[model samples]
Target: MLLTLLWTLQGWVYLAVVFDLYSRRVVGWHMDRKMETSLISRALMMAINLRKPPPGLMHHSDRGSQYASNQYQAMLKQHDLVCSMSRKGNCWDNSSTERFFSSLKREWLTGNLYSTRESAIADVRAYIAYYNARRLHTTLGDMTPIEFEKIA
Candidate 1:
């Protein structure tokens, strides 16, 4: 399952887990509040537009109504992406996504609070950019997500 983490302030910022199946790189992401269809929809659209993952990619997420919603399922169907839903009350199946959230909270969220959502949004946006571009991942051989993707 993906974590739709929001930076609480004037406008919320979201960090999507456009997590890859091979390198586990985050290919697409967006920052937004509302947590409505648009937030995740935008993330998925960006990931598809940019990565063009050769179709039939598997997209997994928890049973949040957002992920299981009709609109989400329809979009996946249109994209020919496989939708894998975690079982009820079970988070183990989505440990990777969960771990990402844990790291985010431990490293960032716990450090500060934003008076406005916009401030939070900005901070989270920078964090995600660094994460995908510069942060090294031991799992990916000390390569950033973008780096690993390039090497692959």
Candidate 2:
């Protein structure tokens, strides 16, 4: 999923994120001034490097051009991941990731004015840590994502 942030100086910053569906943890993410294939590709690379998921792991995404680019598709093929795209005009297929972005903006970014992109990036990075390590999820038996992963 992608998120947009506005700072006082810069017009907009874009964030690309990859979430672990099982644990609801943010496995990979990247922020940039421009939304491009490279942005999402870097995020995917981070997830691939960190998790090293087995072959045939499903890679689900929206019908964004970035996700559909040749480079991105090649990466998925190289990793042996099965690609899955949501139906056109359907957001529900990616609701879990959408919910995460909603929580991020509502819980952490609301009423905050960032002076620089760097500051916003730092704040988002912190929120990711808290989301995985501290925020409780009722779906996970009132445990944080990290705790849920540990137990599972």
Candidate 3:
């Protein structure tokens, strides 16, 4: 998942993407007010409600404060999900996340104007649905994320 580090830019939206470990499918995502515990929590909730991963599933992310918060960790524990965090300040540990954000910015953010956070939230919801269900991934043999999962 990503909390777009656009603090210097115009928007104040927090974006999160949930990628499957095996297929690299972005199974879930959301845009919200801030990079709070709730933001990541909602993203996890979407992934849980969608994929329904087995217990003790592992979720990896960068060592951002949003992911490191006690509330977030507690939620992960509740779901029996193991927490894996990247080392501080290192980008490669979460390179896939970086790539996802780059694609989102290049493919969507640059082409759209969301004057309000609510607008961005709504658009992100639709975009992520398309990303998971329709957008073909070259890495997944040109299959959409959900399709790749089905085949796998």
Candidate 4:
């Protein structure tokens, strides 16, 4: 998600997020002042550590430079994951991530002001926790992501 907290003391912060489609949960995320390969790599690694998904688990993302970087691609290969990229200039292919960002900005971040990077990070962390554990997801039979996981 391209963070719009440009008013922060440190400048704009970019968020790299990995969302699990099964339960509509944000499995991993990272925020940094710059949008770079390292930011995306860290987010991917965090997701791997949390889920340890099977070797053939399909990892889908947009064809962004960060996701296409050699460093990020190497990490995906090392983890034995399969890559699925949305077509260029096609936003519909990745609507789930888009919806997540929309909700994040509208439901959680609208009108919020962050004075520093840490403040933004703290709010994002809190929102992710709420989203995964308590927020009801209509797609998962109206259960929270954690609740759906328990049944699965």
TM-score of each: 0.85, 0.96, 0.87, 0.94
Best-to-worst order by TM-score is: 2, 4, 3, 1
Per residue, candidate 2 scores C-alpha lDDT tens digits across 1-152 of: 44444554666888889899999999999998988998898988989998999999999999888888899899999999999999999989888898998899899999998888899999999999999999999989999999999989
Candidate 3 CA-lDDT value = 0.77
CA deviation > 4 Å runs, candidate 4: 1-7
RMSD of each: 2.2, 1.2, 2.3, 1.8
RMSD from true fold, candidate 4: 1.8
Best lDDT goes to which candidate? Answer: 2
Between candidates 3 and 4, name the one with more favorable TM-score.
4
* TM-score, candidate number 1: 0.85
Cα lDDT, all candidates: 0.73, 0.88, 0.77, 0.83
lDDT of 3 by residue, 1-152 (tens): 66674322346777887888677777767666676788788888988898887888989988888888999999889988899988777788788778877877778667676677777777767766777788888888998878887888
Candidate 1 lDDT score relative to the true structure: 0.73
Selected candidate, larger lDDT, 1 vs 2: 2
Residue pair clashes in candidate 3: none
Q: Which run of 10 residues does model 4 get worst, by summed lDDT?
A: 1-10
